[model samples]
Each structure stands twice: as C-alpha cells, then as structure tokens.
Target: MRRQGIAPLPFAQGLALLDAVLARPAGNFVPARLDLREAQHAADAGEEVPALFRALVRRNTRPARARTSVTSAPTGLRDRLLAAPAEERIELVTQLVLREVAAVLGLDSADSLAPDQVLKHLGLDSLMAVELRRGLSAATELSLPATLAFDYPTPEEIAKLILTRLDLPTTPEATPASAASDAPGDATDSEALLGWALERLSADQLRRSGLLDRLVELARESAPAPEGTATVPAPAEPAGTLDDERSVDDINAELNALLEASGFDLD
Candidate 1:
C-alpha cells in the first residue's frame, strides 16, 4: 500500500532488475547456477558479488537515508512531550506519533497524515502497528494498551485518549484549516465562527485572490484603540485600505502591485 504518497514496494526497481537480467547475454540463463552463485558466491566471489550488492543497495535506497545531517525541532519538541500545555501537548504528541510512524515506513512527513486517517490505511501492517504502539508508549511514558493504535485507528482518537489518560483536555483546538467541529461544546462562539470562515478560505486561494492581504488590513483596522487616550474615530476612507469598500478593479490593482513587489510576474 502507498503511504504519504510513497510506494512501499519498489516496483520500478524490480522492473529495472528484470530488464537488466533480460538485457544481459542469453547464456547466463541457469537458475540453479544463479541460485548457487547467490548462495555460494558471497564467500567465494568475495569482493565481486559484494560490490554488485552494494551498488544495488545504493541505487535502490530511498532518499530518506541519504541525509548526513539531522535538524531537530526548535522548541525541543521531542523532549517536552509531557511538559507542554494540554492543547499544545496533544498536537505535539499526535505529530510525534505520526512522524514516528512515517519514519518506520520511511515516509517523509507526518503532515501527510490527517487527524482521521487510519494507521492501517497508511501501509501499516500488524508489526508496524505494534512498533508504533511501543514507540508511542515510550514517548508518552505511559503503559499504553497493546492494541491502542490498532483499536483507535485514527490519530485524533488516539490523541484524545492520550489527553484523557494524561488528565488533559481533549477538546480540539480551533484553527482555520481544521474542521469547524473542533470544539463541539464551544460551537456557538463568535470567534470560533470567524475562525471557521477563515479556515474555509485556503491560504493559496486567499493569496491568489488577494484576500489575504486585505484580511490582514481589515484586522489592523478593527484592532482596539489604546485605553485612556481620547477615542478618535479614524477617517472612513483611509489610504492603503483593503476593506469591502474597495472595488474589484482596486483590489486587482493592489493584488498586482503586491505580486510585483513579491517578484511574482503574472504577465
């Protein structure tokens, strides 16, 4: 199965191997000899077969193992798994578990993992599942149930369990990209509603539409004035504004200007 867009089996490499075999001279055809050569040649051929095997390994290896240097999280994330606040800790733990799972399978990133995505669906077999359970158990410093990962089937479910076991709030954090049902209990909050609206506007779409800069401007405009200062309402028509008052042409012009400033050539 494919996980995080990575195919576990090297079908291409296998096909290449077959192609190389077929492309070789026809007289090399003895399977028994080939088997014997594979079995006996390691000791007899010494450097010859070993060199070929090493070359194959090098050629077939994934890019994940090609790294000579490793960069760690800026916040010492792996170490502070249990030390961060409830919401933060949950996100970190979920991220960590997902990363570890991805690592075991030689996957690139856990961002490919969704909160509701099942472990098994991501090319996880029984052994991988057990390994994930064990790793998460050690990471969280908890004697987690053996079937924890398999049973929950999803990161969010497992994360909520982790939070509950740790006596932390299991309530989900509200973010623009996350589901609107993040906090079922606080569904009516106006801020959450606004966040939900923002979430509906994807970053790329917002940027391409020039709504992101406008949204930022609107936020700056709506910010509360400092206390104890005489409240003076700003002029209704302010310069460099991107509010609803701006027409499509004006917004498009502003977008073009911003794009040009950012070295984005649309022409």
Candidate 2:
C-alpha cells in the first residue's frame, strides 16, 4: 500500500528546491550584458527606459514608510506671504516696513505714525538712517521723499505714506519695466543693469586684472588728435634677448637640457 502522508523536507532539501526555482531561465530573467549600447542610445533619444529603471530600483530598495500623523507647517511670514494673493502680499510688505521702523525709532506699537508725517515732524541727521530709505526704495521701487528718513521713521507709517502716495493701480499684471520707469533717477536700476552685465564676465578675467583701467587708457589714446596734429605710433620694446648678450644657441642648449631631463626622445 502507498504511504498516506509525507514528512516535511529537511532545511537543505527546502533550500535546494528554492535555488532550483530561482536559477531556472524564466521569462522575467534579464542578462547582464544585454545590448547596453542600444539601451543607452534609446535613453539618449528621450525614451522612458531610464525612468523605468529608476522606478524599479526605488520600489525594490526603498525603506518602508514610517507612520506619521503630523502635517508640516509653513516656515516663516515671508514664506506665507509669498503663497498669498496680491493684496495680501502688499499687506505683508506694509507690516514688514512697520516692524523695521518701530525697531529703528525706539517707538512703541501705539506710537506708530504715518511715514510722511513722521519725516516732516522728526529731524533726520544720520546717513545710516538715509541708507534705510535707499534700501526700501531698492526693494519696493517706491520714490520716497528725501526727508523720509527723518519724518517717516516707522515702517507702518512709511507703508501707509507710500500707499497714499502711490497713484498706480494694484494690478499684479504690471511689468517690472513699467514699475521701474515710474521711479526715475533710481540708483537701484543703474546698479541692477551694471550687475547683469558683470555676471556674464568671468571672475578671473575681472579681479586684480586692471582691465578696466587699460580700457580707459586705450579709449583716451584712440580719441581724435587735437587740431591737425598727426598721430604718432607708440614705441615698440626691444626684442631678441633681455640684455642683448645671450645668443640663440645658449637658449636652445638650455631647452634641450630641460627636454632630456623630462625623458623626451630628442634623437
């Protein structure tokens, strides 16, 4: 009679079965050397092969996700303001100005005044205070009063003052050029234009190069001669040797010795 039941296989036998199952040439198995050049060419042509490989690797090797209940919050006021609408953005800017002014003027929140009225009442003396106005002008592209530093000491007041002074509509669709044109004689615009040109230059070509000075000198030299005076060519430096004593043979001998030491086959 046949056995009614079979015993469980040994660990070794179980492992062997597993190995055989894995080692079999199945449809899912991919060869290591399978036309990599062709695959690379296809990827270069913007095929999805690279993305597919990335997804496969990510899915297989990525760690298990951690269980979490906490949702992330926005970092700062600036970040929150950036995500806000145009009107909200203006409100945030006004608040920022007010905070800065309050800090600078040593005034309490209750003592906040209009920007223009503050400048008109208070006497501004410090250059540093003027610099604050310059900074604000650069940032907001607003043409603040010359006495803004002294009069409109607080940011909240300044914001309100600027808002009142501003005649332009609060449309977000206005171009930067149009905004810049409104603030004529703006130093920030000149600085920006210069900065843009400077960025295209290599740093090495600019620093400690004296190239700008040389350019100025060349410009002066190329200018039209006064009256009918003939332009004279600049004198050329003497060539051949430094002291006019060393012969060509001496230079060649030194070069040959250097080449020989460097393992150059002169023969």
Candidate 3:
C-alpha cells in the first residue's frame, strides 16, 4: 500500500474494523500482529479464520499506547506566526497544507497542485486524509479534527480553516465595511478593534514596527503616579519633539509611516 501511495491503516481504524467484524461497539484495543501459531492451532481444530481472529483479538487486546512527542508544537512557532504579515501568514499555512498533501500523494513538488483541487480527486483516501490532518495539526500547533479534509476538501479552504482556528487575521482589506456592519458580533467600536489588532503582535513585532518605545512613552505620560510615591524612574527623553502632545491616532499614523519605510503598503 505504501508503494502504491496508500497510507497504512491507523491502529484506531484497525480496532474499528475488528469491532465491525465482531458485531461489537468500537474500543481502545491495541492492535498487534496476528500469531501464525494460534491460527494454525485453530485451523487444526477445524475452526474458521473468523473464529480464530475473534479469539486472538480478545486475548491480544491491551490499552493503546500513550501519545508521543510527535504531537508537541515546535518551539517559538506561535511567536513567528504572530509576527508575520497577514498575507504572508496565509501563504505560509497554505503552503504547509499543500506540502503535506503532496507528500502523501508521493508528488515531487506542490507546484503541481491547484489551490482548489479536491483532495479525494487527487487520490487521497480516508487513511491518507487522516495522515494529512495529523501532519497539519502537528505543524500548526492546533488540535484539528480527523474530518479536516472532508470538511474543507481543498488546500485553499484548509488554509482558511487553519487561520481561523489560530485566530489570525486575513488580509486587512479583505473585510469590507459592509461585511463589518453585517457582522455585529465582531469588535465594531474603533478602540475595541484597535485593541484586538494590537493583541496579535508579538513583543519583537512591536519593537520592529517602531511602536514599542512610543507606547512606553505614552504610558509614562498618560499614567503619572501620585506625588509622594516614588515609582521606577522613566528613561531619558530622546532628542525629538516626540514628547509633544499626540493622540492615539497620531501614534497609529507614525506606525503606518514606519511600515511604509519598510516597504509595506498601508493602502
């Protein structure tokens, strides 16, 4: 099956197959290799293969093995994802899905895949789909369901699903004003929206965007301690009129300027 690009049956599915054969409910029974000696003994006694299978299955069944470190999320991946731009984030996740799918199909590269190609049409079976889901879950650090391929059905859709699960934003301009108004459950107030957006940035991202220092300055000026209480002293002011009065919108404009200087498009 592996040679033919078919994924090996998962242990859980093996147990489920046993359940169906035995006319019993599904279980957490561990699947082990069949004993040829036991089969021969049963055959010598004139018993059928199904009878031998039933007897051996009950005897060999044990608790399934505990999950291994393969399920652990890669270190610092969450921070990197948070620091990436919206479009870059989507492309990264999309490529992740494409790569996994292509590998499962034994393809040389994901370039052969169309974004909207149906996974099943590309020769993915149930077992292969399960493998794809496992790979995506481990890579993205998300607990994805087994029916991922069936639910989303395409690389593009799966990428969107992953982004939604990670609570990451899509392209900022993708959400139109009409859609925003229609979805009243969304953070509609300007301050609420700003807070939500800011939460997505990591400390490194804030520093790189040139907003961390400005934010610290604003905090000091806006939150003065009472007269007699000696709190930690603030850092020396920089040689600029940055200390001049400014609104939150003005600070946001400065961030936009910094983004533009870094070759990002504000529009």
Candidate 4:
C-alpha cells in the first residue's frame, strides 16, 4: 500500500488473515450454488442489481445458516461489586482503585503502586486525579469525592474509606498477639514493620483488617528531621504539553505500558 503496490497474493498476510477462512474444514464449507426459486423471486420483484451482478450473487450464495448464540461480554466491575458478599466490598474497591488509578497515572504495573506511595509523587496532578476519580466513580458506580485520589492518596486509604462508606468495619479485627502493646518511640520500629506487612496483603487480605489505612496514615505523617540535616521539598510536576509538542505514539506507548503492567486485563 505504501508503494501503491498491487503485489502478490495468495501472500503471507492474506493467508494469515484468512487462516480461519482458508483453513476451514472442506466439509464445513457450503459449496456456492444458484437458487432457481430466489432468481425467480428477484425477477418477479424487478431487482435493481444488473442481471450479471444478480447471477454472480446467486452463484456465490450459500445455504441459509442457523442462527448461533453469541458470546456475552464479561461482567463489569459495578455488577461484580454489587453481587459480591457484603463482607467483600472493601477488597473489591481496593482492587478497583489500584487497577484504574494505575491506568490513569500511566504506571508500568498495578504492583508498582506501593500502598504507601502518594498520588502526587506518582505524577498525579489535579487533572489526572480528577480523571482517576471519574474513572473510579464510573467503574464502581459510586459518587466519589472530586479530590478522592488526593484525599485518600493511596489504595489502602481509599479501600478503608470504601469499607466505611459501605458500613463495614473501618478496621479488621486485631489479635492479641499481633497487637502487642508498645512504647511511644516504638512507632519508628512499627513503621518499618508496617511497611513490610503492607506489601504482603494479597487481594483477599485487604478486607481482613484496617492495616492498609494505617500504613497510609503512617506514611502520610511527617517525621522530624535530624538536628543538622535539612529536608528538601519534592520537585514540581511538569505542565501539560501542546498537541504538536507531544508524540501520539509516545502517549499510546505510555497507555500500553499501564495495560501491559495490569497483565493486559483492564478490558
């Protein structure tokens, strides 16, 4: 096509494209045949297609086919969320947020979004945050906050809030062993332990406790600086580029990166 070529076929692509059409079992193919009754009916109706065209159509016509049942599309998130047991909504929302937010942020994968990472730190500005909120709202069929992404800032926070909104327990039940009492300065230790614990919460474990939100809270809290060290603020996000300044392929590549990271399962 680029060379204005009328090239060879039976060619590779032509063969590949019609592999199903070509490789069809010989017996399955209905031999084209003329229908005398259909030709008589067309003549009676004074059909507009020329006689030669009509002959060609009749000669290539196959027998009437039985209507086959079509495959249905997969169930959507909203329906899945609604049909899930009352106890399972929190994890549902958590997965939903992680999947959609990662896509909007153009992240490489859903797993790369650590529970403690802030949206802004992951390149989510006001515009992308809004886009995420809208996407989550549409997916879950819930009216979420305009600043939902920034407000929660992490899947753990958003998941906890989802449970709270659904009237489920804000936190999972704690065991006496895991909740061992600690001193005030133990938070630093807890921070590290918490970081390690948060990473292991599989899709099933998210609803079992409030650990996700606690991780987010611990992460969101600011710790004091050492006496001699200075803390530097994060760099600002870049402004949007004009259409001409951006490459369409680059944008698509970024989108594909997110989907590929999602196991290419975002539909």
- Cα-based TM-score, every candidate: 0.34, 0.24, 0.38, 0.33
Candidate 2 lDDT by residue in tens digits, 35-73: 344344444555445443433322224444767858576
lDDT of 3 at 262: 34
Cα distance off (Å), candidate 2, residue 150: 7.8
List where candidate 2 sits over 4 angstroms from the true fold. 1-72, 75-78, 127-267
Model 3, 57-156: lDDT tens digits are 3332444467667744444545656667676877877888899999888799999998799998999999888879877887888999879999999999
lDDT value for candidate 1? 0.58
lDDT of each: 0.58, 0.50, 0.67, 0.56
Candidate 4, residues 98-205, lDDT tens digits: the string is 887788876666987766677778888887787787677777567888878877988879877765665533333545555544323455675456435534434224
Better of 1 and 4 by TM-score: 1
- Evaluate residue 170 in candidate 4 and report its C-alpha lDDT on the 0 to 100 scale: 33
Order of models, best TM-score first: 3, 1, 4, 2
Report the alpha-carbon TM-score of model 4 versus the true structure: 0.33
Q: Give the C-alpha miss distance for residue 242 in model 2, angstroms.
A: 76
Q: Determine which window of 10 residues in candidate 3 has minimal summed lDDT.
A: 52-61
Candidate 2: clashing pairs of residues: 97-155, 98-155, 98-156, 115-157, 118-151, 119-151, 119-152, 120-151
